[model samples]
Target: MTVQHEPDNWRKSSRSQNGSACVEVGSFGDGAAIRDTKDRAAGYFTADRDQWSAFVAAIKGGRFDA
Candidate 1:
């Protein structure tokens, strides 16, 4: 399997508030990266373009809503 690298320009989620559960995202050449805003030193995870798209779609479709 191919490995993905973290992106350079990470930005906090727009829906994030002044809370400890916030996250940040960054876009790489062919994918995206996600990291914890509260523990940046913990590093991050990356998803390829297709995976990222699917995740976003699921979110929009409320697949993750409580």
Candidate 2:
């Protein structure tokens, strides 16, 4: 699937400091857009609303804990 990059407003996480390493996120219709703050022109990852929600929940639940 081709992911279209939108001009929607992108915001970095508040935890981002010095604008060095960070991720930017924005809403694209019923989905979400995520891109590296350091390389906005490269590419981004998009996920449906439900998928995004589940991913966020997993993160909060430490499903990726190692």
Query: Against the true structure, whose TM-score is highest?
Result: 1
How many clashes does the backbone of model 1 have? 0
lDDT string, candidate 2, 1-66, tens digits? 866658478888787797658988898768898999788789788889999999999999999999
TM-score against native, each model: 0.81, 0.80
Candidate 2, superposed: residue stretches over 4 Å from native: 1-5
Once model 1 is optimally superposed onto the true structure by TM-score, how far is the C-alpha of residue 24 displaced, in angstroms? 0.6
lDDT of 1 by residue, 1-66 (tens): 866556779888676777878888898768888889779999988888999999999999999999
Best by lDDT: 1
Task: Quote the positional error of residue 16 for candidate 1 in Å.
Answer: 1.7
Worst 10 residues of 1 by lDDT: 1-10
Error of 2 at 35 (Å): 0.3
